[model samples]
Target: MSRSYRTVHIRDFHDDDLDGIVVLWEAVHNAVIRPVYSLAEVIASCQEDHAVVAVDGDQVVGAAVGRAAHAQGWVVFFGVSAADADGQIAADLLDALERRMAPLGLAKLSVLVAEHDGRVAALAGNGFGMRHTLRYLERPMPVQRRELDVLGDVGGRILPRHLWEAVAGMSAEKRLLEERLVTPLAHPELAERFGVMPPRAVMLFGPPGTGKTTFAKAVASRLGWPFVELFPSRLGDTAGGMAAALRATFERIGSLEHAVVFIDEVEEIASRRRGDPPSPTQGVTNELLKLVADFRDGSGRLLICATNFVRALDAAFLRHGRFDYVIPIGLPDAAARAAIWGRYVPASVDIDLADLVDRSDGLTPADIEYAARRASQEALARALRTDGGDAEPLGLADYVDALAATRATVSDESARDFLADIEAYGRL
Candidate 1:
């Protein structure tokens, strides 16, 4: 039933849909998420929202996200891409949610939506009345990191160390799972159940810095697969032109046997074409869909797509048989965070590694590394002040101050929330 319904039925929300969700959010909302509403906020909404996506074979044509609230409180965060922002998707999300919330006595359902938009009208058409408008806040300040250029190549397509690092710490049972990453050979049981399934699209969706890209890189590196990363801009100048580009992408990917073809922030290439004008990259989605089916067609390349916003995606890309696995990278846990922190802290520094890791809540590995370096620099500066200062080692104060100074840059609160979100949504 689930597989048959993939043609029109709504599927669940996933991290691979992140890029799509973000695009629609940025496009229609005329807004940006940060400071006030971090990526964790989105994950938290998803926590309660029984997000459903509408799929047709290998193409995701529509999507909706909604959940029940107390006293039939409300359902929010529902929208479909490039179309009237309506409850078409909402109704579907709400139907599933109502059942989930029914035991809790979910009564009248509601949604927070744009007043004039068709979606709002559609929700209203579906029995939701206008509610008081709440301002979606935005921060006037610059993004804290000041280093927004995450696009810079981070060690070109090498096997990332962390996945293997994670395996090193896991038990033997987990090692078997990690083995899947190293060897493209799917486990016989899993292969029978999912590997040989009709479509073989792999979706990687999550907030930035959950190591989505790094994990894929690590997997490719571990498997000794040649990796290729593509972007929306690669789709060519015009619609027909884009189709050709899309064809070329897979054609190139197809040639790599037992190789990994990674599409980072893939939703840009995979969004559905609704009533809205098509972006240059529109055709790429359809093309990729066909390419994914080729997995069953016998081209042995691993297809991986990653995005930060999954809600905006077309559902076809998420159909079970298409991608053997759909994974969302959650934020690092306390142990992972502590380990990241420990790596950045030099053995030369005389500080409690445990205390440092405990305090680093929502930090990504990169963030932890940045903070550790600053702390070390500060410690070195302080040591220079004493007569024998050069002989003195860096202390906890340096690490603490280093962390404190960047506190607002990447708030501790944000870190915790992000961590929690990942733990809840992370597939691994």
Candidate 2:
């Protein structure tokens, strides 16, 4: 049995669980979800937002992932093994997260479930409000960066050269870029408009290290724009400098008129326009207020901003039209974790992490990839040193050690606390 009856623990995902997570993700979503997305697209979903899993005995039976933009949230992927002992597991998981979060003081939390999916009942039972239809749009990233400047001939503007090369180098993420950013914002004209505009800003919010930075580069490369990166530490020297610096950022992007500007970990800048520390300020808040106001009505090239702390971001900044569509750069769900696992691990290894991956609850792609890389190194080290360089290929135990080496050491209590929110809210 995949589930163990004695325990169910929820926590952030660890690096080693990539493979099993992917399998469960594909299995549940593919079976129950309507409006099926491309396998690439579907896998990309794993990389967005945050999620939680359920376990009973040794088997994993349920999961729930929620992504937020503005006041709305997409319960993008969720399902329980209907055939598993608890067909109601999806609902139970989500219920747990909401109960945990409600006391923490949030005005609203939203989720989108498959309309026809019985899982909607899980949300309904939890007091979720119904909303409009939503669809995800995407396009391919250019294969090479465009060398020509913005002034180049119109036909020569296919994909700018530098941007293409950056994207091309990231094989898997490149595929995601093509699907999520490049395709939707394919044209320079569109990028410029999106970049310059304020209210309808383009936002990339996801779990940490999901290549939001690379995705930003892909946008810049695809659009042939000059890219500017902003650091949080620098933004808030003085509250007064914020508006001016932001204007400068806008002006710089506009100067290129075809450029793309990126601000990584922007939540810091907003929360720290005054940069005193973690303390929030009226001055900093006001500065952000003005910038967001101006940006919605902005004109010129594209602007891309990314933040790992989506929920921590100010609500005023998230209002519709302030940012056009807030895209999620979530953790690598199961399939993406699988792809990451396969891409990084050699097939010659005899161990399969399917069991571990299934067990892992909330690891990001980067986390999983790092574990794989470390595991491979461990195997090679054993082969070269302990086994006189004739050590057999990596085995399950080698993979297990690799996993143990990288796995997060979460006390059982802490794991429960971190996962308390998701278990209450999402039905994954």
Candidate 3:
């Protein structure tokens, strides 16, 4: 039986496939294959250098040759047979080659493809940024610098650039933040013309699983500022207790040129005070109030505080002058749920998204994400257990099943209370 060349499998080149590889090179390049490497040289490359081939049964249809030196690497040779010029085969060959070379800690991998080569499109599709003929392409590796010290001092971390875009939906909330917080910080001059002083601090209030923390990080990312999450619990064990640690953290934050300090579940330390023998956290709350006042006086910084129960917070904490805006991040609406669902489910899968979205009413973003993941996991397990037949794609039925078994993180009562809180306290 003739070997089928349809199912391309990418693997390391073998000694026995020399003739097929040579034929593939000749067939693809034709006149361009001048001074081709000898069989001995090719064999040596396969044995020593990073090399991979796309094969179908016994036939070699594509090859990629890569070599790494010090902190740099180069794709020296890449060719695919004319008969098998599909972009998928070329992409597979490149994928295999890159996987083999990635562990070498090479700083950069470059390929010099001809201007008119059809493979250029394929390379671009695989994340190879283009450069003009006269210009050189360069990408600098991220290096940790002294500026990051402030983040460490305050128990903070830098968020990735994509986090802002990764926030699936919440158009109204995102827009409000962008206008009330992001716009003033990003374009101060424009804000000044509108009599808008850049926001110094804001409060994010909602139910537990409503993505308040994620929104805080996203805000920092959008402004290209460092994210410093002050953990009150972690500070409680410090030398001076939570109040002293909180003061010291702010002092350290004051040193940085720019920052977005976040404190999640802030009500823990800033809860309403009672008469006579005040709460143990009263002193801590007083210290925090002073810190917020001091922090607001400084420029180039924004403080974000998140709370599950806004009513539990001290009235002074939510006063008009203290917090510029008190935004509410509630459960995902139908449109928001659809967007979140789209993010978790593979686009290739055929499912009734509208039905799923309708069924996911009152679900938080975290809840939807968990349900979608569960559906995917269940589908994957079923596919693995199947013996021979092509596995069925995860459909609406699978997701519905997962949804039935998944517990909603936020209960209806909690959601109603959150709505009430927003009505009573929401500012933006």
Candidate 4:
């Protein structure tokens, strides 16, 4: 008798058995019809969703994965190695997966198989009927099930897809980012043909509230990657201290397939290291430097560090090979200011777009947003006090008043400092 006759046990999938599951998946994939779900989906479901494996001794001979959706349970993956020619193990795996999902109150269990897939008989025997009239379609989700727990632990999230498009202006910055960062990373295959490596780490330095954080989040949304913000202040809350916590955070980040990790006001931790009295941040700075080195070695991840004070960082931290690009984010210009204005002004309100754009010359994106919101709030308050009828709504005058009331986060001295820093340290 063949080794297929040996006793096999069906059990919950262990993390270590992922490799064995991969082998079985590859075996079926190499055969006739391709699996309906991608390998990524199957792997993610195996880890975070429900899964069962049939093990013959130490080898995985068959596997099944399922996901519960309200009253419906869907089979995400089902495969058995060639050794299970009798199809008994395939049936057993399906049974085990169904039992695991029993408590979910699933009224119907279903699966979509590619045309002519050999597992039809096994599924049919397990009481899954053919839905001839029904068709299956899917749009991939940005965040996978497995990454949710890890993402939550790291205070990461999947930003809205509209974020990239919603970035009102900064056309120059947008163009530069698109060419230097987005293009290469988004199209890795094309990038490889041109012999260009996608950027791993980059520094965004500018006057305060210049939308550095917004740009970072937009990039993550555009790339469909998880955005993880590492706050230097919060790191010290861990029992291991800031340096140790920093290391542990990176270790958790490593578990994700792809991520855009941002550290705002990084100068707090990575500032100039001095040996005279041995600065307090020296150890954290050293640990961060090492983390950057290790982060660069990994693929499918980007580290974005933003600082208001570029000159404050350690000289060694800004050296060649540490950051792929040291890009500068400055205040909004004429065209950018106009776009920012358009985003906040209501369509019904007739406002002088050009006048407002020309007036708010030095203001950052955040400043414009605050002014716009304040105008709306004050307009509403005025309307509330008077009779509803003929109550003057928000207008260009309100916006102008709000703009005058708002203070620019970037002052003349800070703006000058930013320009000087760009000339001194800007790489691209």
Candidate 5:
């Protein structure tokens, strides 16, 4: 047999390959006197469910068998011949099996392996993580109906775990958030033991485009809680006016078991009060205050209010009892700008990191993202205009040009005012 592993090709299993697959499986688990799965079962799986085999010409080198039930998929059988037990074969077989299973609309795919199985490391390398250890148990079902699903049709979404990790930079802010917000919610038992009561309400005050909304979503992602964004502007235009809509929305939110509710640009409705005539939004503001008070009284929920102009908000809205903390998310510092630039710049591109970082001193995360996008767009446009010639590689010069053209979203005066406001009222 040729030793060139590159000759291996992955394809759907066939009936003729059953004997080879069974031989490979038996060889891998030779220590087991009794078969883990019967030959008949394997044959049936090859005929009925999704199964892929890695073949080196006519020889079956590996097999992966999976089945989808409901919204979950399981890898029931996977084995590679001892002679060809390379990571490449294992990874390819699993990848092929997953490709076949993906279109079946499964939310998750899982595999079970012995704790000591060396294949565990290979599986992890291919993006599988150990979520839990299973010990099968049987329980009686109650006769009554149970509202076990906390995620109702409340317009809330549960973000994946990777999102929090994807949010680069702002280490100081992220650390503070973990300490003040994530810790209390994720580890309530620990918090209680330390006499640290979980914070229910907090305000994220920052200049525009400073990543307040992103941080809110990241918080929800980190906590594994449902993110419910309350669009006050949209709600305000609904029937019975903004106040009534706000009240109804909160009422609906109360049903959720746990939630991280975010209200962005809150000053739209909760702005500073006016003269004797009073603004129409005053009613909405009062309704919001009442809702916050009630929400604060409850447990298993956190309210995150964000505003670009913290000074524009009503004085009562920022009081100690109303909000637990007034966190400030300012413009990205040098380290943060570098992270933002790194995220948007393609790995293949060559650029000056220090120059880009230094030049992006006053830019927000959003501004840097926009600049990066604009640079790419200009590069593509130039390439197109070059009549099919290879485009000049995107480089530091392109970013510098883009930065020159792009205006900073937050002005120097505004930044100074933000700093002044933070000094006067910032809590964290």
Candidate 6:
């Protein structure tokens, strides 16, 4: 007997839906119409690509999977159970999948189906029209095998997509970076038409815990390139001296096709040179300066260096032609503070968000995160200590207590010093 359901709900595809999808695929295959995508392809897209499913209680009745390539979106899989063949499940799944992929800025969505597929009616009902028939094409990925080896050797990785959007607040910083860095890099041809040269290297300076490193990674993620972090301390681990090690590392980095190389706490190696006998880091600093000059000569790469103390850097290092921009990343502003707090606060908790934001005024993003986590810990402890299991949602009192106990990372003096540095050394 065919089963009937009273209601069907569409949702994101979960790992547990694997079995249901397999059954659906088999049913479609047995009906004399094979899907253009193989089972393996569909399964991979279901996991790694964007997908949505229609579920009736515990049963997955339908699914749609999609993959975005450049400006096009491809439907990798679309199927529904035999019982719901004439129902609205298929349309719902496709709509949900499109909604999930809407943020990718796709210009069009297209799908391939067998010439004699029986489900064409459902697609037509959903506003899809028949376009010119063409043979499907396949090719290897853009990153070749040799490039993978080079990336692994240099300890580089491709960050997840959409990290730029994930960065909550700091609209001013985001806007500046987007215009100065991302726009030119992402649209080099457009930039060239207006007599703009994409920046090759930039420096981010601020007090500790100001999220300079986060912005660097987010830039790499936004550019869809490999992120490689060069550690000054680790350079000493090799057989040669730190200077030689630094040179060798850059030589290896030169082989990669594209990369975003980052060096944090650059003040450690690029500090001012002094004394009659020149410091040990003087050699390393000289090597780094030369490396930066060479790294700029190439294309398809960006170098981001961050430091807590911008004033400690060698004066020559800040000269023109070396770094394109010397941007300051200060503590969280009012709007940023509110966004950071909202990210950590639980939805079930009933706390005054504006009050928390007001109290966190001079705090860094890291400082706010610490206080929020501390608040949760205290709330859990309180619930455990009360008798009769007197459990209640976390309140403003818990967060206020945590805030009082938390030590702010950036002091008033340091905040003033940052402002001074911005005035003296800031370049955009």
Error of 6 at 42 (Å): 23
TM value for model 5: 0.67
RMSD of 5: 14.7
TM-score rank order = 4, 6, 5, 3, 1, 2
Ten residues in a row with the worst lDDT in model 3? Answer: 135-144
Q: Candidate 2: lDDT of 165?
A: 59
lDDT of 1 by residue, 307-351 (tens): 776655767776656776566565666767766776677776667
Backbone clashes per model, in order? Answer: 26, 69, 0, 0, 0, 0
On residues 278-327, what C-alpha lDDT tens digit does candidate 4 reach at each position? Answer: 88899999999999999999989999999998999999999999999999
Superior by TM-score: candidate 2 or candidate 4: 4
Using lDDT as the yardstick, the better of models 4 and 5 is 4
Query: For model 5, how does the per-residue alpha-carbon lDDT over 39-133 read when each residue is reduced to its tens digit?
Result: 66667778899899888889998888888889999887888776654588888888888889999999989877665666677789888987676
Q: Which is the winner by TM-score between candidate 1 and candidate 5?
A: 5
Model 1 per-residue lDDT at 147: 20
For residue 10, model 6's alpha carbon misses the true position, in angstroms, by: 49
lDDT by residue (tens digit), candidate 6, 249-332: 888889887789999999999999896798989999999999999999998889999999999999989999999999999987
Largest lDDT belongs to which candidate?
4
TM-score of each: 0.52, 0.47, 0.66, 0.73, 0.67, 0.69
Q: What TM-score does prediction 6 earn?
A: 0.69
Q: Residue-wise lDDT of candidate 3 within 1-428, one digit each (tens)?
A: 01223687788878787788677655645444442343545556777888888787788888888878799987767788666555777777887888889999988888766545666777888878887764334432222366676667676676786777887778888889899999999899999999999999999999989889989999998887888888888989999789999998899889888889999999999999896898899999999999999999999899999999899999999998899999999887777888899889898997788999999998888888889999999989889888656888788888999899889888889988988998999998
Give all candidates' CA lDDT scores.
0.57, 0.55, 0.83, 0.89, 0.84, 0.87
Total clashes in model 3, counting residue pairs 3 or more apart in sequence or in different chains: 0
Best of the candidates, TM-score: 4
RMSD of each: 24.4, 26.7, 17.7, 6.0, 14.7, 15.2
Give the per-residue lDDT of model 2 (tens digit) for 166-261.
332235555654544555455546656556322234677655666678777766666554555656567556365665655554443443434455
- The TM-score, computed over Cα atoms with residue i paired to residue i, of candidate 4 is 0.73
Once model 1 is optimally superposed onto the true structure by TM-score, how far is the C-alpha of residue 290 displaced, in angstroms?
2.6
